[model samples]
Target: MRKNEDNKNIAVIYWSNSENTEIMAEKISNGIDETGQKADLYNVSQFPIERIEDYDKVALGCPSMDGEALEKNTFEPFFEEIESKLKGKKVALFGSYGWGNGEWMRDWEDRIGHTGARLFDEGLMIKEFPDDAGRHACVEFGKAFASF
Candidate 1:
């Protein structure tokens, strides 16, 4: 994977109520940082989404909520607001799920497909809370995303 991203702009924006998704976000950001690249990380509340066009690549994280769906309250609205704005950007998704065979992630991926963003690989889903290996997986995902 490419370890250098001297001119790329990347963002990792996430919303986490339970803190599980937050941990994953941290690890993913760590992987990006380890590669000598910096990712602008933000909680969805703190994200300056008006500057969406400033980023060439973005990583989004949220947990499954309300029967295998994206978190409806904050994350969903933000995603909807930005969906049409994401055309031509490289977008990656990740989330934590507690049940329902990860159908939520698949549906979310399909939605991204319609947005004109180049969805990177598959969306990463962690069952419930991530353990040590899951954290490693998140880090690896970050590395791969950086290279992508």
Candidate 2:
């Protein structure tokens, strides 16, 4: 595990329509900061993917929509573009959902795994909005990813 003195660069990019996912992103970034790592948090729509290569670890969050899946507009496109660049990088995933088993997360984890990035945690999922526990889990996920 990486120590706080390693000073890794971490990024958290997320897409949220109801602000739930954004909340998780913030918690995750806080966790990264706790590890003495620099963390950049950005909304998926406004994030600059071209700069992703500058980070040592990346954490992504996206809510499930229309069943079990990621929001199509911004999250999918952004991930597609960065997928290849993620090989051998440490990555973490988190999101919120209204229903269904966590199929979206499962599928997403598999997709990200295909890129050869190491997954830090099982990934977090909230039913609708995250409560205190979910937020804390997000933070822990970020810390673990940064330590990787």
Candidate 3:
């Protein structure tokens, strides 16, 4: 509802092997735009983790892999790269999962908490491709995250 962040920049970064998470990231970006803000979307490999401090807010996305865990190779290392810098940062999280009760998100949330970042809200998780409701929720999450 608030469009005061016209000049603010947000980052939506994610890792998606099947590209489902990419769609969610794009939806989050659309939500940020609804708030009259800017969102830069990036694949985890394409984003420079050290540049995380450049954005006013950040949205991180990844799919649950290898038993409801963050991807061991790319996303995990990228997240670890930015973990320390997250202290005092504003952040949101989203992901697509094949199954397993969203335990990966819970673990991720706990990690984010330990970093002292201000969590925008509960992390959004979608099973495989997000349905209409999931996409709507992602948009809402983006709008709220940008406004905050």
lDDT of each: 0.89, 0.85, 0.87
Candidate 1 Cα lDDT to native: 0.89
Clashing pairs in 2: none
Off by over 4 Å in 3: 1-7
List TM-score per model, in order: 0.95, 0.91, 0.93
The full ranking of all candidates by lDDT, starting with the best, is 1, 3, 2
Pairs that collide in candidate 3 are none
Q: Could you tell me the lDDT of residue 84 within candidate 2?
A: 97
lDDT of 1 by residue, 1-148 (tens): 2223667788889999798999999999888887788888889988877978888889999999999998898999999999999999999999998888888889999999999999999999999899999999999999889888
For 41-128, candidate 3 gives per-residue lDDT tens digits of 8999999766887776889999999989999999998999899998887989899998799999999999999999998788999999
lDDT of 3: 0.87
Runs in model 2 deviating more than 4 A are 1-4
Steric clashes per prediction? 0, 0, 0
